[model samples]
Target: MTASTTRRTAATKSRIVAVGAIAVAGTMLLTGCGDQTNDGEAKETKAAAAPLADKLPQAIRDKGVIKVGSDIAYAPMEFMDANNQPAGVDIDLGKELGKVLGVEFKFENATFDQLVLGMNSGRHDIVMSSMTDTKERQQGASKDATGGADFVNYFKAGSAILTQKGNPKGIKNLDDLCGLTVAAQRGTANEDLLKTQQKKCGAKKIKEFISDQDSDSITQLQTKRADAVITDFPVALYNELEGGGGKLFEVVGDQIDAAPYGIAVSKKNPELRDAIKAAVQKIIDGGTYGEVLKKWKAESGAIETATVNAGK
Candidate 1:
C-alpha cells in the first residue's frame, strides 16, 4: 500500500469522473435538439391546416395593404397624376374602399384594355377602372349578360365622339364616317360600336388605334389621319375640356349605347362580391363619391345602388 499504489488509484478516479461528465452533457444537448424539432413541426402543422381564404384576410389586415388594379389611361375616373402615382375618381374610391375593408390601398398600374384581363388572371384583387357592367365582359367575352348580374355598378355612361374643334369634317354622327377614317381604342366597346355601325349603317373605314389613351388617337386627329375619334362619353368630354374645349376638340351628339360603370369580381365568389359592394356603399353613403366626381369635373350621371345580394 505504498506511494505507487496511491497515485494509480487517484488517476483511475479522475478518468471515470471525466467520462461521466461528458456523457451527461451529450444527453442534455440531444434532448434540447429533439424539443426544437418538435416545436417547429407543430407550427408547420398548424399553418398547413389553416384555410387559405381565412388566412388571407388576416394577412392582408396585418400587412395593411390591399392590392388594387386599374388601367391608368382613363381620365376623371382613374389615371396617373403628375407625381406618377395613381389619382382620379376611381383611385380615390379605391382608397376609401380599402379603408372600409380595414386595409391600405396599393394601386398597380395597367392598361385600360388589360384591367379586366389582369383581374381574371389573378394578378390583382380588385379593378377600379371605369369598367362597364356588361353581360359580355362579365362572362369574359362578348355574349349574353347571363352571368354578369353579380357585379356592382358604381357609375353609368355610354360612348361619344371626340372630333377636332368645330367639327370641320361635319362629322356629326356615326353616319358621317361612311368612308372616312375613325379611331377607337382596341378591345374597347367603342371599337365594337364602330365596327357594328360600319356593318349595319355602312360607316366603313374605321381606324383601330393601339394604346388609345396616350393621346395617340388625338394625334391621329391633329395629323388629319383620322376624321374622328370615338370613346366613352366621360373620356371624350374630358379630352375636349383639357384640349381647350371647342378650341382643340368637341364632342358631337350623344353617347352611343347604354351601359353602367361597374367593378368586376369573380362570379363564383359571392363573399368577396358582398364585401366590395359594402365598401362601395360605404363610400356613397359617406358622400365621398360625389366629392370625387366634382374633383374630376366628371359629368353627373344616374347612380343606382345595387344590393349585395340583389343580383346573386
Candidate 2:
C-alpha cells in the first residue's frame, strides 16, 4: 500500500475507534440520566411520606389524658353533682373509659355550640356531651376539625318538657306551647326541635337560655319568664329531682322523637375512636355502665346497647 493510503487507512481506523467511544459514552449518559431521574423521584417520595403519621392510626395510648369536651349543662348525663365536682352517668362512664384505657381523664366545659367548634379546632379530643347524633351534626362531626372520626352512639335520648308542679296551662307537648314562651338552651337539639316545631306549626314562643345548666332554666321558671322549659328527658328528670324529686316541678308529656347520644372523634383519628369504643364496651360488659346510670338516677332510659364498631 502507498504511504498516503496507509496514512488514510490509519486515520479512518482512529475515527472509527473515536466514534465507538462516543457511542459508549452516549449510552452511559442515557443510563445515568435514567438512574438520576429515579433517584430524584425517590427523594420526592420520601419528602411526601414525611407526614405519614397524619394518615396512619393515631396513638391513643400516648395521649395520657383522654381530653373530653362537654357542656356540663346537661344534668344527669354530665354536670356538677352534689359535691360541686363533675358527676353524672356520662362523667362516670368517661372516667371508667379513661381508666380502662390507662389514661387520665380531662374535661373542658363550653357551651353547646362552642363544644362543636372546640372539637373542630383540636382544642379538645372527644365530646362526652349527651349530644344527639343527627345527619347534619354527623356531617359536621365527621369533619377534620372534629378530628376525622365519626360519632359513636352510646346512649338513646329524646326531648321532654319540664314545667311547674301543676303544668298550669296543661302544656302536654310542643303543640300545647304554641303561644306560650318556652325556655331552651341556645344551639342545642332542644332549641333546634323547638325551631322546627315553630316553623312547621307557626309557633314562635321560644326563650333561648345561655346554657343548658339547670340553674338557667330554674331561674327562668322562678321568674315566670318562661311558661315551660324544654330539654332532654335526663336533664328534665334531673332538674325535677334536684329541688326535691318531682316535688318542685313535673315532667310533662312524652319524649319527642328518638335520638342517639354519640361520642364524636376526628375523621382522621380512628385509632382513638376505636379505643374509646372499646373502653365503652368494657364498661357495658362489666355492668359498670348500668351501675353508673343507677347512681346518677338515670337508669330508667339509659342505653343498654353499644353500636360503635371500629373500621366500619
Candidate 3:
C-alpha cells in the first residue's frame, strides 16, 4: 500500500523542477476578499479570493503551486492514462485540493521508492501517491537522514494477493505464498510484508523478484518469473477489472492489514501540512470526496473525515 522510498538511479534524470518555498515569508496572502470581473482579469481575481489561501505559509502562497511527488503507476490511485496525462483517483483529488488552496498541486512523476526522498530534498512540496501512512515513514525509519514527514490521512486500503489468470498454482492467500516465487516492488510495504511472510515459510521461504515499479512486478507474474504479486487492494482489484477485462490477473483472497493513505508533507512545512489536512476535510464534508472515490470505483476506501498521523 505504500510507495517504496524509491531512489532514482540517476539524480539528473529526475523530471521534477526544484520548487523550494518562495524564499520570502513576508508576502501578503489574500483570504476570501479579492474580485475582478473584467474578462482579462477574472482568473486572477478568483485565485486571490480563495478562502483557504491564507492558511498556507506566505512562502507557498507567493509561489502559488504545491509540487507533488508521485509514482504515477498505481491505477485507480495514480497512473498514466491512455492520453498519457496523469489520471486516477489521486489526480482527481489533487485537483480538488488545488481548487480549494487556490494553488496548483503539481504532480512530478518518479519511481515509487524515491518519492518521499524527493519531497524532503525540496524537489516537491508534498507527495500524494497512494502512500500508506505508517509510523515508520512518518519517522523516516531508514538510513536517509532528512528526518521525515507527517501524513494527512485521506483514504484507507489494505494488502491483497494478485496472481496470474485462472488462479494458477492454486494460490489462494498469503499462506499459499510459501515455497513460491513472488514479485513485489522493492522498498514497499508489500516487500516488507513478504519478508514477514517469508519467516513463516520456514525452509520453503518464498523467493522474491523485486522491481522498481509494480508494473514490472506484474510482468514477473505474467512471465512465470514469479508466482504471485503482493499489492494494495485497489490495485489488485483494478487490474482484475481492467487488465484485458480480467484475463490478465485475479485476486485470490480478502485484503489484509487495512491502513490509511496519506499526503506526505515535510515536517519542515507544518503550515502546508495542516492546510492540506483542513482542505481534505472540506472535500469530505462537501461530498466531492465521495464522488471521486466512486468515479474510480474505490468507494470502499472512503472515509468520513480526514485525520492526521493515524497510521499504525
RMSD of each: 10.5, 16.2, 15.0
Query: Tens digits of per-residue lDDT for model 2 on 1-312?
Result: 223332334567866766666687789899999998896676445434432212323344334456788888667788776787887788888877755665556877877666766876888888778877766665564331233336777777788988887788798778877777778777667877777776655535444454446458766875777788888888788777875656677789888775777898766677777666666776888887888888878776666566652111
- Prediction-by-prediction clash tally: 1, 8, 4
Q: Model 3: how far is 52 from its true place, Å? A: 1.7
What's the lDDT for candidate 1?
A: 0.68
TM-score for each of the candidates: 0.73, 0.73, 0.84
Q: Which candidate ranks first by TM-score, i.e. highest?
A: 3
Between which residue pairs do clashes occur in model 1?
Answer: 135-145
TM-score of 1: 0.73
Q: What's the residue-level lDDT of 285 in candidate 1?
A: 80
Cα deviation of 47 in candidate 3 (Å)?
A: 2.5
lDDT of 1 by residue, 1-312 (tens): 233323434577866766666687789999999998886665445434422223234445445465666677777677777998778778877766765565556788876666666666767666666766665676655432223335677777888888888898888788777677788776667777788878855435555554446456767876778878888888888888887544788899877875777776657656666667777776778787777777777746446474432211
Per-residue error (Å), model 3, residue 175: 1.4
